[model samples]
Target: MVVGLGPGSPDWTTPEVREALNAATDLVGYTTYIDRVPPRPGQHRHASDNRVESERAAMALDLAKRGARVVVVSSGDPGVFAMAAAVLEESADPQWQDVPVRVLPGLTAANAVASRVGAPLGHDYAMISLSDRLKPWEVVAQRLSAVAAADMAIAIYNPASSQRTWQVGAMRDLLLEHRKPDTPVVLGRDVGGPTESVRVVSLVDLDPADVDMRTLLIIGASTTAAVDTPTGTRVYTSRRYHRR
Candidate 1:
């Protein structure tokens, strides 16, 4: 099954995902995602590094090829920037074509963070991963500029790491061209887990030095609005598509 695993918190694991784990003969996922599952008796684990997608999918396919039931794990809804895509990509091989693959949805970091900070994605939004390892920086910048100019709420993934210091600052600068410097920014780190932390601040006050691989940043568009309600200030990224 392709389980979302939901934001790394046990509470986010849906009953369906738990059932998949309990019945699995083998588990395949990144180390951190595998750690979240703990150890169930009689279950074998195949953990890989952050770099190996094809190898991980091959491992799951082999286990299932040998007639073992396997649960491929991923953090946060697997389909959203996670392992589910890799599994499907590899499953297209004729050798594993007949294997029955089930995908279970878990809460993705974006949803988890958005929930905590009111509705930043309440209307239209775009999710962009700032990792230049897989994408060219020029392309990343173009997308950032276009989306920011389009006034869509942007959820940035893989914002900053020790090795990738400048993406966040570059992104901030790009957005500043189209968005107010004081626009609200939501930084969600290690969300939905024990180390979970969240902060809401303005773009001008955002410090790139505070970001890491575990952080997810939500940047509201220039046109984004916040209205005080009984519950809290609700934020929305406007969608001109709905305007008549």
Candidate 2:
């Protein structure tokens, strides 16, 4: 079973995920996600580093083939830039062909962060990962330029990390070509975690330094609007478009 733990907050974890964790004989995942599983007296935990995702999947497959009820955990929805793809890639191995793999969904960061602010994604939007780990930087740049030109809201995942720090700034500069400097942008860090924070700033004012691996950036489309009331700020995109 591959389960999504839902953004580090127990409140976001679905009942299905909780039941899977409870029934798991062996739990395998990155250290942080494995730590979220509630401890069971006889359960075995296999915690690996963030970088060795394929190895972790292989370990889980081995345990499963040996008749252990193994559960693999991902921080958010497993299918979205997480372990599901890795597990699927490894599933192609003939030795693990008969393994019964199951994927459970959870709240992904894009929609989670969008809810915290407002319905900024009410219109067409593009979800892209800025981590060039698996893809080339030039391809990422071209997509950003096209998305900006098409006037679609963009949800940027894996915006910045300790190792690769320049991409976010480069993305900001590229978007400026097709978007105005005053376009609204949102930076959500550790959403649903204890230190959760969401800030709305102009495209020109978005600071790359303020973002890290835990952050998700939402860039508004041309039709997005922000309103400030006594309660706080609310951002939304009109469902209908009007010709100017």
Candidate 3:
């Protein structure tokens, strides 16, 4: 089974996922995600580096074949840039074909971040990862340009990290080509966790230095708007579109 922990918050974790965790005899995941779950009396954890997803999936399958109720835990919804795909890919192996796999949904980071604000994703949106480790930067740039030209809101994941920092600034520049300078961009860092911070800025004002691996960016479309209320500033994209 694959379980989602939901953006590092216990409150965000689903009841079904919690039940699966409790029932699991073994847990397999990236070290950080595995550490997020409190250690149980008898549950064995197989934690690995985040880069070694294929090996981690194989480990889970091996344990499951040996009569262990294994659960692979991911930070957000496993189906969205998480372990579910990795596990499924590994399960295609002839050796693990007989092992049954199941996935449980959890709140995605994009949705969690959008909720913190008003509803930046209320209308049509596209989710893209800026990571070039697996794919070339050209492909990432092509997708970003296509989405920007389509006037669709964007939920950007893996914008930057210690080793990869230029993508965010480049992304901002590319979006500027199609989106207005004043387009709303929400920066959510460590959202739902103890160090959570969410702020709204214009596309031109988005600083690459402010982003990291823990950050998720929501770049709104032309129909998106930010307004101040008695409570705080709320950002949302209009559901009703005006033909341009």
Q: Provide the overall lDDT of each model, using Cα atoms, as 2-decimal numbers.
A: 0.84, 0.90, 0.94
C-alpha-based local distance difference test score of model 3: 0.94
Q: Against the true structure, what is each candidate's TM-score?
A: 0.90, 0.96, 0.98
> Tens digits of per-residue lDDT for model 3 on 1-244?
9989999689999999999999999998888888989899999988888558898889999999999999999998999988899899999999998899999999999999999889999999999999998899999999999999999999999999999999999999999999999999999999988899999999999999999999999999999999988877799998999777
Candidate 1 structure quality by residue, lDDT tens digits, 168-204? 8888877888888878888999988889888777787
TM-score of model 1 vs. true structure: 0.90
TM-score ranking, high to low: 3, 2, 1
Highest lDDT scorer: 3
lDDT of 2 by residue, 161-217 (tens): 899899989999999998889788888899988899998999999888999999999
Model 2 residue 70 lDDT score: 93
Which candidate model has the greater lDDT, 1 or 2?
A: 2
Candidate 1 minimal-lDDT segment of 10 residues: 235-244
How badly does each model clash, as a count of residue pairs?
7, 0, 0
Worst 10 residues of 3 by lDDT: 47-56
Ranked by lDDT, the better of candidates 2 and 3 is 3
